[model samples]
Target: MAKRARPGMRRKAIVLRDIDPPGTLATNLFRAVYNPVVQAWASGAERIIAAYAATVSEMTTDAPADVRAEIDGAAEQINRLVLLLTPDLRRWALSVEGYVRGRWRGAVLSATGVDLQTVIGPEDARQTLANYVEWNANLVADVSAQAKQRIGNAVFSGLSQRKPAREVAKDIREAVSMSRARSVRIASHQLSSLSGELARERRREAGLEVFAWHHSRKAHPRQDHVVRDGKLYTENPALVGKKVDGIEVRAAPPADDRAGVKPFCGCRERAVMVFEFDD
Candidate 1:
């Protein structure tokens, strides 16, 4: 029997990458500073005010010079970085948290004996995967856009003498396209890691068989393409390329007790049945 992932223990491998980038200092520092404050606030907003006051008092003028300097340096770095990337970081972080706690962990638990809906919420498992894939695609778009903007700004910032407007525009455009392309590639790599983490979670779920399933964005499954053998292959054409043994891929209702999934799940429209390998 495969060992199950511990409850409340997040997937370690991909979570690090999904974290928001720091403006300065170590990235984890932000989480360190923010998590406690947030936890305090969540527990009791009134008491959190007193806790906040205590935290403020902890930073006294009599503190050692070395300690003060270290704190100042870290603060400055974070401030600078936040100014530069706050908008993007904020947007991405919201999505990342949902993917980890709700999407990723939820699925892992549902696959095992735990009822995710009862433990967390009904939407936890499916929402986790859905938001992960959706936000990942959005991250690609945002990165591409930011890369283009960066390249354009970089080119204009340069002191170029006697450069024609049209020529400069064309050059900047090409550079931006290349930059966005690179960003897409990098984001794709990150998403690939996320995919692997999801797969790992699926493997760790107990008494359930999980299969990777993709369906067409449109109503017609016939129109979709899948990556196989380092090439794009259509469903019809690839059916002849390889034979899957005793693996019947089809769409069907989940077992009645499956994490208490409702009959008319909103995700059902996009769902494809994946084989669960369970004892």
Candidate 2:
């Protein structure tokens, strides 16, 4: 005979299953920013690569000075390209911040049915937006600097090897291609992390009692052990004197490693709402 399930257990299962997971806002924003930056970088890199390839044969040990100058010039051009793109990158950061902020506000409302504007003042929202914008801007600048360094190193190594001009040019092109792929991965991971952090912060401000970790289901094996599906945690454990406004929430023990906080993590957090009065 089939056994009947307990009413309380059934309701708990439904609530867990009904919780909304994090969206793809971060990935989308990463792609939006990465595409244009890569396109522009490719265009500039081609010009630099071509110029080097044309003059590579002139870089013999006897005429090393001219070759060195050419390499330096290429590096200078890469830096200049990054500088030229800064303003546009900053603009994109601001746009992404605004979009993420809106999503944060909406997520809080959906979870607790309380508008963030009513709980947290407008000034706090603006400050949060500003923080996200600054974070993205810094990420862009860091990626750009890393790219320039990689290109410079490739050029130096190729020229130093006294290889044929065409071969050296090929090396530089390959380096740039690898760097482009890496930068996209890095940017995507960082953006997702930022999104998760913002969501957690807004939920806390909205007075949500507990937050659950939501895995992407597509996460690698290493991340699977960090937090099981539907696991929850308290926002502050040290505040013993603080008044508790909601039911005590608990979950599996915290992981020893910071898997979800690292780069390339796809995990997100969901606010676990506990209502004082039944709806």
Best by TM-score: 2
Give candidate 1's TM-score: 0.30
Encode model 1's per-residue lDDT on 59-93: one tens digit a residue: 45432333334333433443343344444434443
| lDDT of candidate 1 at residue 134, scale 0 to 100 | 60
* Pairs clashing within candidate 2: none
Q: Which stretches of candidate 2 lie over 4 Å from their true place?
A: 1-41, 60-63, 77-132, 219-221, 224-226, 238-260, 276-279
lDDT of 2 by residue, 137-229 (tens): 566556555655665666667666756666666766676677668766766665665555556555566555555666656636444545455
Clashing pairs in 1: 23-81, 103-128, 112-206, 209-276, 209-277, 210-276
TM-score of 2: 0.68
User: Could you tell me the lDDT of residue 231 within candidate 2?
Assistant: 58
After TM-score superposition, the amount by which residue 244's alpha carbon in candidate 2 deviates from its true location, in angstroms, is 14
